[model samples]
Every structure is written in C-alpha cells, then in structure tokens.
Target chain A: MIPAEGFFWSWILPALIFGVSLWATVALYRRFSR
Target chain B: MIRFGSIDIFWTSLFLLLMVGGAFWFYRLARRSESDFFLAGRGLPWWLPASSVFSTHTATDTPMWITGVIYKDGLRGLWYTFFSAWTAIGAFVAARIFRRSLAYTQAEWQSLRFSGLGAELLRGWMAGWQVFMNMFILGWVGIAMGKVGELVFGWPVWVGLIVPSLITAIYTLAAGYWGVVMGDFLQGIVAVFAILLVSLVGVVAAGGPGEITGKLVELGQEWRLDPFAFTGVSDGDFPMLWWLTMLVIAVVGGFGMGTSIDWYVEAQRIQSAKTVRDATYGLWAGGAITLIRNAFWAVSILAFFVMLPDIKDTAVSELGWFRLGFELLPMGLIGVFFGAILAIHLSTISSHLNLGALYFTRDLYQRYLNPEASEQKLVVVGRWTTAVLLIGSFFYGMMMEEITQWLIFALWLMSAGIWLPNILQVVWWRFNAWGYLAAWMANLGVSWLVVWILPGFNLLPELPDHIQFWLLMALGACFFLPATFLTKPEPMDRLVQYYVMTRPLGWWGPVHREAVRRGLIEETKKESGPVTRSMGIRRSWTPEAAQEWTREDWIAILLSPLVYTGLLFGLVQVLLMQMEGFALLGAAVIGTLIIYWVIDPKLKAVSEEFEAGQARFLDEVEARSRWEEA
Candidate 1:
C-alpha cells in the first residue's frame, strides 16, 4: 500500500497546484468578463 | 521485438485524429484576412493565447533535457530554466507596452518607435534576422523530436525528423495561427496529464518520498535536495561562480527578452490578445503552468534517481526520462505518454512554422516585393513560406548528431553578448538602430576572435562561460556607446509620439518636454502659481492623458517573483513529504491570494477603459476612411 504521507506528497501537492491554477484562471476570466 | 500492443496503437491513433480534426475546425473559422491568418484576427480570449504560450514552450526535448540535467547536477540544476521567472515578471509590465505599441510584428515596431533611414534599416535588419532565427529555432526543436523517436520507437533519425515535421506543417499551413493556437489548447491538456501520470508512477515506484529520501541519504547525496546549498561550493557539478553566471543569464536575459519586441511568437501572442489585461493574464497563466510542469519533472527525476542508483556509468543515465516511462509505465499508458510527446512536439513546431511564415511573407514579401498586394495573395505567399520552412528545417535536423555536445558548443560560440543591447533598446532613450547594429556586429566578431579564431591560432586557451560573458559585455558596450554618440538620435517628434502613446517608464526627459510643450501631456500644478520656463527646472512631466500605473500594478509586478519563489519552496517541501512544511504551503497559498486580490480588480478596470478607448479610435479611423472614399 502507498503510504498516506506518500499520497499526500505525490498526489496532494500536484492536485493543489492544479486546483489553485483552475481557481486563479476562473477568477481572472470573470474579472475580465465584468 | 516487444512491439506496442493494439491498444497502444489505437490510443495514439485516436489522439492524432482528434488533433487533426481540431486543425480542420480552426481552418473553417479562419477568414482570408491577413490578420486572421497571422493573428486570429486579434480577438482571442486570454486563455487561448495563455495556454498556447504555455504549450509552445514545452518542446519535446524539454523532459529529456530536464532529466539529463538532473542526472548530471541534481535538483539544483533547474536554476538553468527556473531563472525564466524574471521573464514572467517582465511580462507583467510589458503587456501594456506591447498592446499600446500596436505594431503587427516586432519588426514593424521599429517604424512606430523611430523614423527616417535609421528606422527603415532597423526594420529590414530585424526582419532578416528574425526569419533566420525562426528557422534555426525550428531546426533545434526538430532535432529534439528526432531524439524522442530514436529513444522510444528505435526508429532511424530521419523518420522521426520528417514525420512530425510534415504533420505539423500541414495543419499550420491549412489553418494558420487560428489552428495552431486551438491545437495548442488541446495538446496542452494531454501534455499535463502525461506529466502528472509519469510523475505519480515514479513516486509510487520509488516506494514514496520517504524511501527515496532514505536511498539518497544512504548514498551520501543528501545535498541533491537543497536548491541553494551547493551554489558556491567548488567541488560540485556546478560551482558558485558558474551558478551565479547562470542566474544572471536567466534573470537578466529572460527579463530583457521578455520586455523587448525581439522574439516573434511571444510578441505575436501579446498582439493577439484582445486587451492589455488579457495579455498580462496570459503570461501569469503560462507561468503557473510552467511552474507546475517543472515540479512534476523534478519529482520524476528524484524518483528515477532512487530507482536506478546503480545504472550510473552508461548513456542510459541521460535518457532517464524515456527509461522511466518504458520501465515503469504499463503498456497502454506508455502509448498515451508517446501521444503526449507528439502533442508537445507538434504544438511548438506548428507555432514556429506559422510565425516563420508570418515574418517571411508579411515582413519580407509584402513589405518589399508588393506593398499593393491583396490580403488573399499574401495568404498564399504565407502558405508557401510555411512549406519551405518545414522542408528546410527537417533536412537541417538530419545533419545533427549528439545534440548535447553541439548545444554546449553553441553556448560557447554565441555567449550572452546580445543581452545588453536588447535590454537597453527598451529602457534607454539614446539606444538607436546604429547602436543596436554595432553591438551585434561587435559581439559576433569579438566572440569569434576570443573563443574560436584565437584558439585556432593557439594563442589563447578556450575561456570559460563566465569569462566569455564578461568579454561580450565589455565589447558590446565598447561598440554600442561609440555608435550611439557617433550616429544621430531618432527625431524628437517621433520620440515624443512614442512617449505619449506607449507611456513607458524610463529616461525620456527630452521627449517629455516636447510632449508637455505640444499639449500632449498636461503638467500638474502643485500650487496655483505662474510657472517660469527655466531650463534647469526639471518639470515632472506627468501626462494626465497617460494611464498611470496603479499601486496594484506595482504590487503585482514586484511581488510576482516572491510569490512564485514561495510556491516553489513550498512545493519542494511537500514533494519531500515533510508534514511540517505544510505550513510553508499555507504561506504560499496566502501569498498567491494576496497577489490575486491586489491585481484582479485593477486588471478588470484597466481592460474596460482600454477597450472603450480602442472602440472610439477605431470608429474615428472608419469615419476618415469613409470620407476619403466619398
């Protein structure tokens, strides 16, 4: 089994990066649309 | 022969078909207008060009190169490309500068900034040099794809070189910039998926970050983890002085190229954006994508190191990226990864072909051969130029072997001599065409004499990169300064026009005075008193008409690098699986949000104002054209 810590490091960080990126992208788009 | 299974082939074929279908869709949307063909009618939303910019920079060789660097110098080695953060910072400021200039291409920008014979000469020189550089860049990236083919499919060099080049050329020629950008959007998604897939597999294969750290510590290579650790150490893969030099090149060179209208496709992206805020956001988006991409590459390299500790002596070490995919990825997934590589290669190549055709057809043919040519005729010429570039670069890629050694040799050959002139042309008022021309000539001559010519005569040993860098700087200054003083500056009227329109932040004292005198700028009165025309009184030429940069702009511009640096460090900690570093990740998140809060409202306000102003200007232009026709 992959360690919980391993999943946190490998998956969580990238997921955060992607999640934040998507949020930021949407925020930027809406900012312009207004 | 362990050939690919039917599933692998099917997956790859499906992706290719989708990309080709995307090409046809964009082709249908493209009109016969030159602007549509070259720039997608300059009506693209921020994300299109943003993702296109992100995708274009991810050349196929990028993964292989990053993996090789890790094999040689560890994680600290990423400073080579990481310094590009400066370019992103510069982009924040340059977005407005590029849009306000309103020139179709970087070469055409020469006439807008200057006038007379000097402007004409600069335009011609830039057009010629850009065409050559575009072809050269296309060839370099082509060589990388060729390596990818050889590594993955065991195909001969030429097959890898020709096939992708031909495919990309066809779609680019058929749909022009519209197709190229749309294709990039689709390809960027696949590329991201592939990067994450491989990185996740590598981490799991290495028994997670904990086991990987143990292996590294056991090997006495714990220094591999720290970014700033071995900077000045003399006994490492890269010494302190060498690291400093690379830092300077990345930051300074990146910022210089970032701000200047020197690169073709980047400036095209800026012009292609509908509003200045859209252009600025594109850069921000591109930077975010790049940072994420780099983190995944770093993780993969670290995992590769742990898994293959004993395979240190052979060329296989340098090919760790491909080796990891083949060794760790399942059969069906391997096919997806190959499709991703093709996506990477095609996206970059398509942009180059489109932009190269742009420079050749618009700048050379239409400008010189027939200024009265119709837009339809120019589009035809553009297609022919694309074909020539695609064929030419493929043949050039075939002649290359052992690109690693060649890349090193090319670095030594060219050095960073062109950097100073490039930066100064934007910031300084005195830098002119003759000055720029002299700098390039001197850099080339001096570099050849010092690094190659003199070494041939056995008079001087081959110098290090730092030495060559300094020599180029010294010689570049020696030539450009004398040329500036010797040749006449651009006309004052032209300078004032540029200053009023662009409103660049720099030393433009004389131009500011002219603008004030001509009523183009209103001098702010601190007190209601009669002003005396004293030559010595430095009037703070605050042009009321010029859009003043707000505090938000300043924060976003100055704090971007800090925010990214925080995020990079925070990501590194998380990748190492240290729970305590989650606090750092929290700090990074807070910092990014702070930037977003500061810049978002300002960007919206500014974009609205710019669009309104542009609408009025276009209306006036239409009215005048109609009057003349009547």
Candidate 2:
C-alpha cells in the first residue's frame, strides 16, 4: 500500500545500481581487451 | 493445491525446453578434461560466473525464507540477510588472494597452504566434509522444491523432488561447470522476471499503493511500513535487547570472518574466473543481482500482507508465498512461475552436484586413490559422483518431509557451528590443521551437548538461541587455540610459499621475513608507499617495510560491497515507498560511482594480463590440435 512516490523511487534505486555496475564492468572489459 | 491449466503446462514445458537447450550450448564447449569439466578450463568471463553464483544461492526456499522474515519482522527483518554484505566485502579482498594460490578446490588448499601429515589429514577431512555438506544442502533445496511442487501441481512431494533434480543432474553430469554456469545464467533471468511479474500483479491486485496503504492502516499494521523501527514478533512488540544482540553477533561473525561466497560452490565459481579482476567484479555483480532479487520479493510479499492481512502466522509461514503466486499470477504466468521455481531448485542442485564432484575428484581421487588418473578419467569420475550425489539427496529429501522444521535446525545448529571455523580458515594465519580439526569437533560436540544430550539428561536448562550461539563459538575458540599450540605448526616452506603467492593481508610477519630472506620477494618502494608485488625484488629501501592498502584495493576490494549492501537495503526501502530512504538511494549511486572510478585502472591492468594469458593458452591448444592431426 505504498504511495505512488514509493513506486517511482523503488524502481529508480535498483535501476541505478544495476545500470551503473553493468556499465562499469563492461567499460573495463572493453578498455582492457582493446 | 492449485491445479495446472493447459496454458500453464505449455508455458512450463517451453521454459524447461529453453533451460535444457541452454545447457546443451555449453555442453559442446566442455572437453574431457578435469579443468574443463570442473572449472570451465578456468577461463570464464565475469558475467557467467557471477550470474551463476547469484542464481545458485536463489533456491526455491529463498523467497519462502524472505517471506517468512517479512511476515514475522516486517521490513527491518532484512538485517538477517544484510549481514552477508560483510562476506561480500571479504570476498572482494580475498578473490585475488584465492585466485593467486592456484588451487583447484579449497580442500586442495591444505597442501598449498600447509604441509606434512597434518595437512594431509586436514585435506582428507575437508574433502569428506564438503561432500557431505553439499549433499545436505542439495537435500534441503530438494525438500523445498518438493513442497513447491506439491502446492503448485497437486503432485506428491517426492515427485517434485525427483523429476527436476533428475533433469538438473543430467545436464550437470554431462557438461559439468560449463552447463551449470550457462543454465544458471538463463534461469537467473527467468527467475528475476517471474518475481517481478508476481510483484507487478500483486500491486495491481491490491488496487495500487494508496489502497494498499489504506488496507494496511485499517489492519493496524502501519508500523510495518517503517524500515528503521524494529517491530518485534510480527504481532508488534519491541524486542530491544534481543535485536541488539543479534546485530552484534552477526556483524562480528559474518562480516569479520566468513568468506563472502559459499565456501564450496560459489567459491569454485569465483575461482574459475579468467582473472582476479573478473573474480572480484563477478562477486560485485552477483551481490547487486541478489539485492535486486530481494527487493522484488519484498515488494511482492508486502503486497501479500495488504491483500491478506487477516491470515494467521502459522499459515503464512507454511505457505504464504505459494498462496500469493497461485492467487495472483494468471494461467500462463503460473506455468512460468512454476518453471521459475523449478529453475531455482535446479540451479542450487546443479551447483552442489558439480562442486561435490570437484571435491571428490580433485581432492580425493586424484590426491590419494589414483594419482596417475588421466584427465578424461577424472572427468568421468566427476560425472559419476554428480549422479550419486543427486540420487542421495533425492532420497534424503523424501525422508525429511517437514521443510520448516529442518530449516530451523539448520539455521540454529549447523550454520552457527561452522561459522567460526569457516572464517578462521580464510583470515587467521595461526589457524592450522589441528586447530581446524579441533574447532569443527568442538562445535559439533558442543552443539550436540547443548541441543540434545544436556536437554535429554536434564543436566542443564536449554539455553536460549543467542546464548547457545555464544557458547558454540566460545567452545570452538577454546578447543581451536589449545589444539593449535599443542600440535606442530605447518612447515615453514609451505607457509612462506602461501604468503608470497596469496599476499593475504594479515599477521604473517614471521613468514613474510622468511620469504624475503629466501629471496622469494624483493622489498621496493615507490613514491606512493612500500608496494609488495610477486616479482623478483631489488635491494632498495626508501622507508620502513609496512603493508599499506592501495586505493583500488581499499575502495573496490574492501568497501565497494559494503556500499553496495547499503544500496540494496535502500532499494528495498524505496520499493516499500518510504521517501525518507531516498537519501540512502542517493548515497548508493554516489558510492558506486566513486568505487567504479577508483577501481577502473586496476581492473584494466588485470584484464589485460588475463587477455595475454588466454591468448597464450589458445595458441597452445591450436598447436596441440595441429600436432594431433599430423
């Protein structure tokens, strides 16, 4: 029964973590391999 | 029991086909070699191993356990699982250390880290214990799967345990670690989406957040929305002191000592990474995924609370998650959900089978029974062992019908008993073979005395959970210290070799000096500080020899996981719609950016080194292939 604000932000935190870590790892992999 | 519709059956069958097809894709990559079967030829990229590690830990029981926690303690109940952040930090630091040791299994580490009869005995004992442990875990997961099957398909519980387990065993036995990892990757994706689907359905079913909140308030359970408040007993009381005691013990034991990964299967997955960089990043990725999984489950379970507030504690504990999925997910999605549950059970069992086989084949068969065994023979043996383990776990699961009862016993007894020894084996320098033997013996003996013998004889009152935990850890220390002192220390040569290779940060002063004297490592100083690299040393001294943490090592290896752990908790809070948790979310984003910035250079360097190594390996394989053709 969380508010709409809760729904919006809940999605944001996990997305932020997932996007950032994935980007970091892929960037490192590409840089090193090249 | 919920009856399966045709749409459910079709979706479940399709999902199962995808898993099997993915397993076959990896099967072709596997060769008839021990390393190929057991460690993916020790050349996995970060994502494969990381995804596998995350997937393997997400057993069928995971959501059930999380639901039980939320049912009993509300949002604050995450502390129980959050403690693993410490282990993740420890893993980040230890990933390179374990990888550098160049041992195939942790059991084989006995020979790499120590020497003589004591080392041999410890190696054998560890092999046996790990085999037994994996089977126990396999059986535990099987029991959970059986329960899920009984609830979902209206089938006998044993039917549930045997069928999916048999399928998992076939792929694992055929392709070893390769199949296990690939299967895990696919299953991990499906399971995540399934959990998300359930959460989405629940949210809509509850008439959105406003209505859900209204329902919660009407039920007089508004406090459940508070992430910081420790509402005790789920019925709503303050458990002030008890909560504090648990926090202290968990931080000290789980964070301070235990490896971030499962000491067996997950450790094996990390070790199989192509480079130390991959190993560390893989764990970080896995940790992030695990957090996301938790958030999804938490969201769904909270919605369940809103929809079914009047349900009793016993009923919720036994079948809360099952009922929620059955009630909410549509016909086709129910099949998907069922497939996802099977996937969860499959991932756990496959890793156990694969890892158990590795321990037996590498640590026992090669080390003792058949030193001359060929790679192909070892691979065959590993496959056979996987089959045996799967069958054994199936029978054990059938016998242990009551999942809830066994789950409690496992948490309070086996987990507590092993916690101390498990940690000491990784971090403490003085914890030798005898000490390990003594700690486990004392833990089991004392656990038996406190839980069974003393209570049975009425010699003393049954100690409370916290008191018993302390007693077991204390008894472990008491026996371990005495045994270590009384027995001879490990040989100096083995200790020095281990210190040089692993470069573990700890009290290894004597061994370090010996290694230096033997010209194993040279002391050199850069402007930054004294840096110890495992290369030929030059006779130069700029400052006193002292171990200092590199920026990358400190931030990426030690602190990133801690930061990520907070990020995960924050995500859970956000999902619960607590706006105050936005600050924590901000901190997580900032922290992740900082760590990524600091660690990128180190990861780059390590990745390049791994690339060169892999190139050389590929060249050799090509040469060998050509020679065989000639």
Candidate 3:
C-alpha cells in the first residue's frame, strides 16, 4: 500500500498545483473579462 | 520489447486523432494576417499561452534527463533542474519590459534595443542563429523520441523520428501559433495527468515511500535521501561551488532577456498574452508548475533507485522512469500512458516548428528580401518555411549520433560567454550593438579554446562545467567591455524613445534623465526611493503612476526567487514526509499570494497605458525596419 506522504506527493500535491493554476486562470479571466 | 494490448492501441489512436483534429479548428484565424500566424494576434488569455509554456518545456527527453540525474546523484540532482527558476524573476522584469516594447521576436528586439548599421547586423545574425538553433533543438528532441520508439515498439529510430513529426507538422503548417497554442493546452493537461499517474504507480510498485526509505537505509544508501549531501565545497563530483554557480545563474539571470535558453521560447508566450498582468502571471505559474512536476519526478526516480539499486550504465538507467511505467502499468492504462507520451512529443515539435518559422518569416525574409510584402504573402512564406524546418529536422534527427560531440560544444557556445552580455543589454543603457555583437564573436573563439581546443592540446586542464562558465564570462568581458567603451553610444533620441516605452530596470540613469528633460515623461521622485522601499514592501497605481518603476515591482522581484527556492526544496521534503517541507511550502504559497496582491494592480495599469500607445509604436517599428526613419 502507498503511504499517506507518498499518495500526497504523487497525487494530492499535483492536484493542488493544478487546482491553484486553474483558479488563477479563472480569476484572471474574471478580472480582465472582455 | 513490451507487447501492447488492443486497448493500448485504441487509446493511443484516439489521442492522436483528437489532438491533430482539434488543431485544425484554428485554420481560418491563423491565415488572417502575419501577426495571427506568428503570435496568435497577441490577444491570447494568460492561461492559453501559460499552458503552452508548460507543455513546450515538458518535452519527450525531459523525463529521461531528470531520471538520469536523480539516479546518479540522489536528491541533490534536483538542483540541476532548478535552472528554470530564472522565470520566477523574469515574469516581473523582462516579460513586462519586452511586452511593452512590442517586438515580435528577440531578434527584432535587437533592432529596437540598439541602433545604426550595427543593430541591423545583429538582427540578421540573431535571426539566422535562432533558425539554426531551433532546428538543432528539434533534431535532438526528435532523436530522443526516436530512442523511446526503439525501446517500446522495436521500431527503427528513423521511423520513430519522422512519423510523429510529420503528423505534428500538418497542424503547425495549417494553423500556425493558433493551432500550436490551442493544441498545447490540451496536451499540457494530458501530459500532467500522465506524469502524475505514472509516478504514483511507480511508487506503489516499489512498495511505497516508507518501504523505499527503509530499503535505502538497509542498503546503506540513505545519503541519497539528503538533498544537501554535497561532496565538498570544491572537491567532489557534486560541489557546493557548482550549486552556488547554478543559484547565481538561475536567480540573477532573470533581470535580463535571453539569459537562459528557455527565455527565447517564453518570449513568444509573453507577447501572445492579452495583457501584461496575464503575461506575468502566466509565466510565473507555468514555471512554478514545471518545478512542481520535477519534484514529483525526483521522488518517483528515488522509488526506482530503491527497486533497482545496482544499474550502472547511464544509457539503461536513464530509461528508469519509462521502465517503471511500461513494466508495471496495466494493459489499458499502458495505452493511456503512450497517448500522453505522444502529447509530450507533439507539443514540443509543434512549438519549435512554429518558432523557427517565425524567425525565418519575420526577421530574415520580410526584413531583408521584401519590405513591401503583404500579410497574405507573409503567411504563405511562413507556411513554406514551416515545411522546410520539418524536412530539415528529419535529416538532423537521423545524423544526431555523429553530431553529439559538436552538440555539447554548441550548448556551451550559447550560454557561457553571452550570459553576462545578455543581462547587460537589458539593464545597462550604454551597452550598444557593437559590444553585443563583439561579445558573440569573441565568445565563439574564446569558448572553443577554453572548452575544447586548448584541452585537446594539453595546454589547459579539462575544467568543471561551472568553472568553464566563470572562465568564459571573465574572458568574454575582456573583449566586449572594451568594445562598448571604444564605440559611440546609441543615439540619444533612440535611447530616450526605448526608455519611454519599456521603462526598463537597472542603470538607465542617463536615459531616464534625458527623457525627463525632453518632457517625454514626468520627473519621478528619486529612483532610489523605490529600491529602498522594496525592503518595506507595498501599492495602488494610476496608469501614469504605474509607468515609473516602483516599490511594488521591486518587492515582487525580491520575493520571486525566495518563492521559487521554497517551492523546489519544500516539495521535495514533503514528498519525503518531512515537517520542514510543510513549512517551506507554506512560505512559498504565502510569498506567491503577497506578490500577486502587491504587483497585480500596477501591472494592470501599466498594460492599460502601454496598449493605448502600442499602435503608434508599431508604426514606428515598421518605419524603422524600412529605413523610412533614421
């Protein structure tokens, strides 16, 4: 079985990075909406 | 050789069709004008080009190189990848400055930054060099994909190189940057997902993080887990001096354009963004994600090490990550992984194909051959050039083995000598076209002697890479510094105009003072105030107020390196389940948030003001190109 830290690095951290990037994009779109 | 199931073939075929077909959707937009073909009309939302930046950098060979270093040096290998940190400060400094200047490529920026016959010569030389360099990059990357194909499907390397490149070329030829950027967005998503999935699976297959660590300890290889386990200050294979050199290069290189090789690629994305704020955030976020991806790969490579601790040959061991996935992934998922590999390959190929074409079309043909070329004619030329680059890459890919020696020399050729001059051109107002040109010429001869020729003759010992970089920089300065002082400065009017438009950072005092004297700009409070206030941190900015370099910009610049360092080290530690990792990661996040809060408003204001005058600036650039103005 994968340890919690292993799962976090392999899974959760990547997901969080992607999530934050997506959120930033949405925020940019909203702020600079044409 | 690994056997592929029916499900694997199905997934791979579907992904190929989807990416290629999706690119065609932009065919009409790409054909509308020269700008559309090369720069997507410079109206892209930040995210679109941000995805392109991330996707383009994550080429087919990226995983191989990362795995090779991690397997050999343990966690300290992560520092090798940290060179991407240049973008952290570059997003705030060079990206903003270049966006405001409105140059199509770094080659074109040459003419804007310098003047007279020297500027034109530099522009032509730079344009030609970029075209050749891009082809070289395409060849190297293509050959890497060819190797992967050989490994997985038992296909000939030539067949592997040509097929995918041909497929990517179809869309690149049809829709230009429009297709490349749009396709890259989709590819980036798929590539990231595959990377995460494959890395996680590798960890699970290796008996998890805890087991991997325990095994390393049992084998007396626990030092591999320590990121700071350097051999010595200057003695061992992985020395502190080399790390220090990397830190300086990565962080300080940001203040200038073209400091890192990746800057040329990122320049296109910076200009393509809809606004300056978008450009800044896009670059920062893309680079941040890339470093994060490296952290994941670093950890997974460790897992590979624990499983197979005795592999010696770099050629076989470099394939460690791939071995883990292909050997361990289930049938249907293997196909999905292969599809992602195609995504990785195609994104990089398409980007370089389009980029090389831009240099040829904009800088070489239009500037020299036909100043009166129409938009339709220029786009036609762009298509033909894309085809040529694609054909050239095939020949280059096939002959890569014979040229590998020269390729290493070529890599050093660009970085070591020209690095400081690259920074000087941006920050120092007095650095003219002659000095810049002389630097390139001097570097060519000096680097050949320092890196190879002298060593071959036994006149000089073979030096470490970092020592060579410093040696090249010092020797190069001897020639270019004299060339700058001996030659006349760029015309005062030209310097004033450039200063007004770009508001560049660093020692531009004379230009700034002249602009104020001419009533071209307001006399700002002393420039030193902002530099001083950078330490305190803080601003709301009016469009006029934002034009001046201020504390907010300084604060962002100061914090950017910290954030990048924190993210790189923090992610690695967290992967190892260390407590300090959590703290470092938190600090990085907080730093990022503060930068956004401090700088975003000013950037928006700067973009708004700059766009209003961009049309006038474009006309001036056109007139200058035609020699209609002196």
What is the CAPRI rating of model 1's predicted complex? incorrect
Q: Write the per-residue lDDT of candidate 3 for residues B1-630, one digit (tens) a residue.
A: 895888678667766777777775677789999999989888987888788988999988999999999999998899999888999899999999998888899999998989889999999998998898889889999999999999999999987799999999989999999889878876787788788888888888778778878888999999998888989999889999999999888889998888899988899999998888888888998899899999889889999898888889999889988877788776766776787888889999999999999999999999999888999999999999999999998888888999988987887788779999999999999999999999999999999999889999999999999999999999999999999999999999999989998899889999999999999988756433332134454454556678877777888999998998899789877877778899999999999999988887788888898888888987888777666874
Q: What is the per-residue lDDT of model 1 for residues B263-288, given as tens digits with 9 covering 90 to 100?
A: 45678887788887788777667766
How well does candidate 3 score on lDDT at residue B94? 91
Candidate 1 similarity to native, TM-score: 0.86
Q: lDDT of all the models against the reference?
A: 0.70, 0.68, 0.86
DockQ of candidate 3 relative to the true structure:
0.07
Flag regions of model 2 displaced more than 4 Å. Answer: A1-34, B231-261, B313-318, B402-414, B457-459, B526-548, B556-558, B603-630
Leading candidate by lDDT: 3
lDDT of 1: 0.70
* lDDT comparing candidate 2 with the true structure: 0.68
Q: State which candidate has the highest DockQ.
A: 3
Q: Give me the displacement of residue B51 in model 2, in angstroms.
A: 1.0
Query: Which candidate wins on TM-score?
Result: 3
Q: Tell me the TM-score of model 2.
A: 0.84
